[model samples]
Target: MHPLRLLVVTLLIVTVNLLFPGAAHASPAVQYTNPIAAQRADPHIFRHTDGYFYFTATAPEYDRIVLRRATTIQGLATAPETVIWRRHASGEMGAHIWAPEIHFINGKWYVYFAAGRADDVWRIRMYVLESSSANPLTGAWTERGRITTPWDTFSLDATTFAVNGVRYLLWAQQEPGIATNSNLYIARMGANPWTITGATTRLTVPALAWETRGYKVAEGPSVLQRNGRLFLTYSASATDANYCLGLLTAAATANPLQAGSWTKSPNPVFATNATTSQYGPGHNSFTVSEDGQSDLLVYHDRSYRDISGDPLNDPNRRTRVQKVYYRADGTPDFGIPIPDGLTPARLISYDTPGAAVRHWDFRARLETNVTPLADSQFRLVAGLSGSGTVSLESTNYPGYYLRHRNHEAWVQQRDGTTLFNADASFIRRTGLTGSGTISLESANFPGYFLRHRAGQVWVEQNDGSATFRNNASFTLE
Candidate 1:
């Protein structure tokens, strides 16, 4: 072969390899093994600068600020737990620190959490603690001071977000003028962390049915952004199983400071199990997993049955997580309550195999030169070889993306025939006739196989199944 021919063949082989790197990987939604972690609630998860996940939650029985770090969600549970801050004396700073949040701003680390006087749980106010190191685990935290505002009333659940280089703080409070329960408020940050630039603008009050469930409240705000829109997701209703999630959104072109600028969703975005034992599903924070695929929603919910409707009495509000999704429009559609045993969608990884007929939530890897399909009928391109983890998705399916290995992997399309591509144009559907030679990709491993008649594409050991019909229009598994 000529030198140019050799280069073309080599490039084709590499393109195919990249297209279907993992042909025999796990199903994206395979249930994650539990207990991912134990006894955590009001989870505050943040992806650290160092590519690790840092998590904090409400320590129900203790007065200390707890922190956990891990490379993966499952690893977080086993990662050693650290108590960074504890209550001080008998005064407002001495007791009942709740919903602690850690943030890295400027050149140092700051922890924002609400604490109350030892004797009174209602005196809860948000305070800040500082650390010097970039890596939080190695730093020593110094008490910065209580974040103050214009009002002297009770407040808690303080959170901050920076928009277009402007910093803003939000919290729940009972202003002197408002007679109802705690409402949500937002304000601009001043020169120092302690100062407020202007009067706090009231963002929301109890209006929706979910917001008025137990105490007519709306608090615990966490923000999500997409397509130049800002979404403020907050917990509402009583903390019992009735606890739910609500949204407030505004366009990037709108004034974030104007109270009317943010539009409230008429219905709750996420909620608790009306039939199941899960209760009070609120107080959530969002984070992206290591692979940067989907948004993860981290909140606390009661695993056990709730005898009382009151949010305060429930002791089992443990931390839980589920994948957050978006609708056809830019708005979010936080689907039904995900069960505790439900596994999170897998992040696309290099070693994963991606082949499957269903194309269920698997994604493919893309490079500039890779060609997916010859035509809609499914033809292979000689310039491309199904070499690496093949990332491909079905056109008609929303949640389906599959990656599989090349040699041992097979795909059964809607016609129910085992298939593989040739030259990106022709289709050749084969039959295993039995389950002996199949494998399915998984969250932690490559591929596992079962009965062939079970209707799932299986892979051989260490094989990836991420190939598809068309390269140009295809998405990887």
Candidate 2:
């Protein structure tokens, strides 16, 4: 070939390499850190078709409805919030604005919230706000008026969902004949969301001992539909440490307005786990992850169990989120609320697809079968600087981190030792698969990579073989 032709080919190759560097290496897995927004309770996050997640929750003051949107769930944490609506100074909707949920329906955005009148603070009722704009965060929200119930009584936590081409509204209210503070009810909604068309049916009351712990309350209902079943989860007890979640299940084809169609779980489905130091883990909403592969539970909880006076006055109930797992029986397994901090994740070995990297007796090893909660979870934190490095902190053992000493990985306690910091941090890199896989290179050892050999983890130099590449790659879940 002529020299001019050779030069042209080399230039083209260089241009292609520069334009698509990722084609030569694996892309980093998408990961998100949680507690998306702090000091915000009753979080309702909905991912719209516009590729943004709109978040709205009850402000701590309980005087206004605030909203924020972001391209990613974690981005909502720092996104500027807009006060869409505020409580009136006197008449109805004058006080106690709570649990505002944003929904897009029939080309309009609707916000359903619970509010009370200034004269009667305890007389809580549900109301709706409508926005015609595509983006709810920037639009003008007009009052759609109150959602009146059959009996004039306390009603709140209004949530709406459509199944089989029919929309239904589910909420908690104080029934006239029932002695309990509130009960779960459902009614078919009319053309407008603020109006209910059919007869209301009481689904569940605070009859169980667990549901009536502090206050005979059954409120804050949220829905999750899967596997031919409709799961309606609601908060029970009081809004303190006794606060928990209860489940009411019905078939997808069953008539939602019929009280006989639903079966209430005898016990609370999700409750406070003292082991995780999370109290009052209730008022949950569900959303799918950005990738559309994982379902997340968005809720609020207090880090501490003790509150100053009334739990209602406590401002520590902050918004949090976690992955929701499903059981083989087609039911949701809302395990315990994980401890607060950064989001916890699992490390899956690429060599053996389903195998996970776990710590047992402070030693890191590849376990084909591992327990879900403690052993396999780690909080991946950015290392010392923004140098594309990371440190793995054990979820169960607070300050302990994954460190390599003498070429083997072990869970070591971080005791302000210089060697510990140097050994614990690993430089994150693209995986061998060239997409959504992660490879950790030892920060201190430079060229060495974290790998599993004979089920034990070790730091070794890459051999550029299929086995070595597979051993070094991991999926951050």
Candidate 3:
């Protein structure tokens, strides 16, 4: 290329970036710290058309419905919350105000939540509150009264979504004849947004042994439509360490009103990951990022395992969020609950294409179908050695960092030694093979680069091999 043409192209790129922010650097919404809001359980976040994310959840006090708004998902962590509605002194909606989901439907905002009577606190029922104001924080919330189900039994966790231009309501309720505590049901909400006007279909029951731990239950339904299918997820079992998420999938072209159309996964998709120290991770809601490209999983989980007395009394079930990844077959691979702290990213190998840098038996390697997905996630943070470089920290194991021991790249715990620091630190360089890729050059070993050989990752100086450039470079996904 000519010198003048190269200079003109560089100037054009800079001008375009200056005129439009994020025009050159398009980073998706994948980086967000965990425990987004402390003590906010059964979290539900909705990204509305107003370019604001609306968040609501079960307050620790279990006595009021609250809402908050922010432009970015991470901004909601410190956003001021407003008490939209409180529990009644007595009678209907008197206590146990839980799992409030805010949604904008047909130009009106509606909040769906559960409450119990003051006289009998266990008399849990579903209810709705509506608002006409553009901003939900300033509107008058008119009570829409109780949503009458098939039986006047235990019911809660009501969620609503539209499928193929038709709206439907999904919730958990106890069937009159069923022995389980509650079962999931769904029906169409035709003209009225608050009423179920069509045939009610039973989606799941507590038939599996895992679903009957502390109590036989299945609740908290959330749906995501993608890849020509409607993927529905729900919480199951007791709200203890046994609490987990189960999946049910149905084709988008099939009738959602029929029980035969949906197929439920035999096992739990997302559950308690003791390794990550997240327990009873359940009752999740799905939302997209500001770019509307990445799907974010918003749920609640406790950092500890032990809960004295009833799990309901525990106040440490904090709200959290993480990006959901997809498999080659177009299905979601939820993996497990990511440990606390920095948001992690996958290191996709440029040479192997789809294979990612993952840890196996404490050693780093580039591989596909990595189990417990956190093994493939690494947080590139400010260098433990110094600020001039970066250190790759393991997501599942918080204190551990990826460092070279005898030229072998391994995910090991930080030893607080100068040698460990220098070995772990690397200078992120532009891709040696192509654009949009990165090569990590060892800070201590100078010319040596982090490369993959025979599937294993190692910090080795270039051997003048044909695959040297391709092996050392990777694309962060």
Candidate 4:
């Protein structure tokens, strides 16, 4: 291989060894379901060092700033929520309460949100609320006034992160001279969490064809640090189905204040995955799995496409979470927004690294680059037969599940029979092959294990050979 190619391959191998299989088991990722929270747009999930995933978002009513906390990502779905603050009756913080994000800064909790005047609902501006108590829900909050920018234009969706001990704020704003509805900007902080210092740097605008649909917009900024680079993501277009995500990348070593350091991707990264029936997926925040190893994408979208009247008047946009994978080059491969019902994953075999367990034409086997994509994906749901077992339900097939009939693995629809439940269930255990993988044992046939032979899947008795371990062991993706 070329020298550079060799280096890239080495890095990829190291990353795969470090991030997958082992990190996969740290969280019960399958327990999650889509639409984690309903009528919550511009959602933000912050995994604080307190071992809690703090959540806040734009309420469908556009009225109050609310918060929820849970130890695990899925727990947030039903965790008790508290209204930390509400909109004022008049003046600056009176109307259009939107996109609230909670952050722990300088031993205190701070919330950044956008608000408008009661009389002028569209006159939105970024505002702050501070709490000295560690538990933000029960703590008393004080209004910290507005985050004043160079020019007093419409600004919202404020997010902040610290790199090299320097804290910087990234937000969406309408510049006085700019023709676009909004542009992304970044600036270092002065003394407190609510203030910005120095000249602001414009990072991205609505220049692409897709970004200009419905509205000339570039907003909802979020940043993820990985692969020795800063990946800044922003939402664009109107709030309707046209809204999508765009990315801006810059080297970690460069001066971020210099506009030349960042490069904007010509196309959107994650958008409305029609195959998944998820529409207008945008305004995302990044958080890690409970293990602090696997990165997770947090965002919101509607289950349906069309709206009755104004899209903003519709309240179905809901919060969702999914795993984030990386390419060999170390960039994030967001893939697509998964379909609703339950969280989906691909069972990747250890031996066939390029392929995953997929069902094609009702035949369960390993395949690479499967089309419709959903054919290769499945949900690991609670066993239909009993507790302490798992059933792999086909992502696209829905009611159908991967089952063993005459020891052969196949995707078959449930007939509502006791035998069908047992045939579809399997007990997950430590890899029969080795570490960084999992083994599924037949729930009905005690000694039988799901393995691959000649690229075909089968539930067979383990012979205690290295080949059996290699064939039976698979990693959750």
List, residue by residue over 309-335, the lDDT tens digit for candidate 4.
988889889999987766557787676
Instruction: Show where candidate 3 strays beyond 4 Å.
Output: 3-29, 433-435, 462-467
Q: Which candidate order results from sorting by lDDT in descending order?
A: 3, 4, 2, 1
Task: Give the C-alpha lDDT of model 2.
Answer: 0.84
Q: Which tens-of-lDDT digit does each residue in 267-329 have in candidate 2?
A: 887888786788998998999888876778889988888888888888778888887655447
* Residue pairs with clashing backbones, model 2: 26-434
Q: Which candidate is the best by lDDT?
A: 3
Rate residue 138 of model 2 by lDDT: 81
RMSD (Cα, Å) of model 1: 10.6
Q: How do the residues 1-477 of candidate 1 rate in per-residue lDDT, one tens digit apiece?
A: 999999998886577457654433222332233335566667898887787889888887648898888988767878899888788868777776788887777877778888888887678788988888777776788887888877877787888888888888888887788765778999998885555688789999987777887687888899887768998999888777678888999886676789989989888877766443456678888887567766777888876645555456445667776666444365665655544553333222222233223332232322221121110111111211233322232322212233234422233332322332221111112112111122222222322321122333333333223222121111222
TM-score on alpha carbons, each prediction: 0.69, 0.82, 0.92, 0.84
Highest TM-score, which number?
Answer: 3
Worst 10 residues of 4 by lDDT: 22-31
Distance from true location, Cα of 330 in model 2, Å: 5.3
Report the C-alpha displacement of residue 106, candidate 1, in angstroms: 0.7
lDDT of each: 0.61, 0.84, 0.89, 0.87
